[model samples]
Target: MREKLLGLVALDRLPHACVLESGTAEERMALAKDLAKALVCKSGVDRPCNTCDACRKADSGNHPDILYVGPENGRKTISVETVRNMRDNAYVLPNEADRKVYIIDPADTMQDYAQNALLKILEEPPTYATFLLLCTTKASLLPTVLSRTAVYSLSPVVGADQSDGQLEEAKGLAAELAKALASGSETSLLAATSAFEKKYELLPLVLEQLGLILRDALVAGSGGEQMISGAGKSAGSLSARYSNAQLLTMVEAVEDITTALALHANKNLTLSRLVSRLAAGM
Candidate 1:
């Protein structure tokens, strides 16, 4: 994936602006920093060689040519004043590198006025200047801003779930969830309970895989099955207790918690509450 993105930001091309989205803000920031290093590397290699002086400065956030625009005072949103400052810096010649790189983090958190303020610079960006916007809220961005920049979405890592030769069993679980969702029959509910017991007997350390399965179920419209996305055998055994709608609501609630966790919310309590909610909803 890094190689693919490096190709997109081709050094041969001199300069360009882009927006890269990732599953987590941390991952997005890491990618942006690496790209900044690559842009200013004196060696002009595909990636920055950390041994080089330019690379070291960039790694330390001391690179004169790389500017960052983010919330001041750890605020949640970037202000229009910050955007104005970024625009002023955009016109200046590179201090120590061939190109100037601007990275905007949590671009989605920028207020409407701030985004509009950024539009003028994006429309007629300085020569050899590059802008990269890292955001998770693609829908919230101004359409004009999106139109000027190349956009890329980083998908949630697949197979991040822990299942030991359980793909077949998972498929079976999918079918069961699908059936339960289709019919409000008592047998369907009982089957869901049984599936929870058989498939997720021991929960995986990483819940992402299970979460993905639940998301897939939602996409497939199998609401009944989605409720059991995080359930272990202990919980699955009583799946019959939940209605299809109730299970779906539980899944949605969990997804909301997942979003909160990604934003650096209290993970332990949030997860425990999500689990408890799922159990209760069922």
Candidate 2:
């Protein structure tokens, strides 16, 4: 992830909008700030040069052109009115930097109306504007919003506040399953899926772990293995066994299964179909 971001900074090919999928709020915010700072940096050679004034301002969270929008007043969701204001403000000229960057923390917190309202600006954002949508659950977001943005999923940052212990455990099991699926270990795959019977609720976490594992494998196949963490063995093995296209298919399959589970799809059937697809792909 750092390598990809650094390459973007080097090539000045950063997307107009991006989705950072991360469970840890602290990691999300830190990445957002780093990306924002890099976008507005004067030197522009290496991202977020700590010595730069723009980087300093971003570190202080007071950059006039670097704005943050989120749910307010203990509200559970972001209001449409706030999105409306953001749409209006997006057209405004940057105060100091060459670009205006807006970071929306937990963008999945936006209600349907708010998400719809924000979609307009995302589609035809101002030339000098950029948007960063931080989210834990991509399933809650509109496909339109997702299609118009670059999506990057990250694992929980080490030592950060990790309250979801079950999810972590699920990921461990999922990692083993992913390796088994890639290696065509039918017995292991069946056994792993059987574990889901005792805790079907962790299906989402399992699917997410599989997606991340496949993503890393594809990256490794494409020469970015250094970007992967926690799933390096599975990624390395999968990359050697599958082509990039095949890895991508598995990633999409995992994401689809995850979204289906999130929407209350049949667990047994989904698990069966998922394993079938994984097996067939290999």
Candidate 3:
């Protein structure tokens, strides 16, 4: 996650608009916030220091220069009116900072007309303005808008299973699941889960791999294991501090992060905290 944060900050340095796509809601939201902080930050570092006034304001959700829009009320889609508000508000110069940052969270939820309206601004955004569109999939965005923005696809962490011959299916499924989970729409998750269930006949083995991932996480948690050897380990002393149930619960949390990662959920808070929890248990 630190690696991702650094890379994103570097990308922010470039004078270009970005459409950050994540697999889970948590990951997407986290990425969006990170980008916003980077944009408005006064630290002038690769990543937002999270200590400066600009970073604090952004983190506190009151940065005058930063505008966040998302699904309003019961409506799943961001209204045309909201986009208009963005269009109108964007013209105003920054109040507190050099750059005005507009973050459209779950940008994919914008209705077609709203997206079309937003397209004009991205087509020729004013100077001193930065736009960050957060989405789970680039396909949901208008091509016109997409063409004008730099798209960075944040993929799930995929690797071999803990034991056995290579599970090619798991790897492929992991990629697909990552994309679906990152997608901001709930409908996408339901559809993807269903599709994954239908296409992959190796549920038990996949579950086993998940179990292995948990074990590695546990071993890694206690610092009992020197290093993870790709999928399987040779032989090592087992960390007996945690019970089977606790280990299982930890795995469940990891799976939650997995889902969150897919949905573009908050990455720094979720991923970093997850690691922290594992280390704590150790």
Choose the strongest candidate by lDDT: 2
* Alpha-carbon runs more than 4 Å astray in model 3: 1-12, 156-282
Query: In model 3, what is the error at residue 150, expressed in angstroms?
Result: 1.0
Q: After superposition, how far is residue 248 of candidate 3 from its true place, in Å?
A: 48
Q: Better model by lDDT, 1 or 3?
A: 1
Model 2 misses residue 108 by how many Å? 12
TM-score (C-alpha) between model 3 and the true structure: 0.53
The residue pairs that clash in candidate 2, if any, are none
Q: After the best TM-score superposition of candidate 2, give how far the Cα of residue 52 lies from its true spot, in angstroms.
A: 13
Writing each residue's lDDT as its tens digit, candidate 2 over 177-263 gives 877877677777787788888878677767766666766676677665343337788888888988877776676577568667767
lDDT of each: 0.63, 0.77, 0.61
Q: Give the best candidate by TM-score.
A: 2
Across 1-282, the per-residue lDDT of candidate 3 in tens digits comes to 323334334333333477888768788778777777777787543347678998898999999988888888889999999998898888899998878888888898998999999887887787878888888899999888887987766763344353224366654443333333233344543454454335434433343344344444344444533222234221121223444445555455545555455466663464454444333323
218-275 in candidate 1: lDDT tens per residue? Answer: 3234222223234333234323444446655655554566456556665456545544
Lowest lDDT 10-residue stretch of candidate 3: 229-238
**TM-score-sorted candidate list, best first:** 2, 1, 3
Report the backbone clash tally of model 3: 24
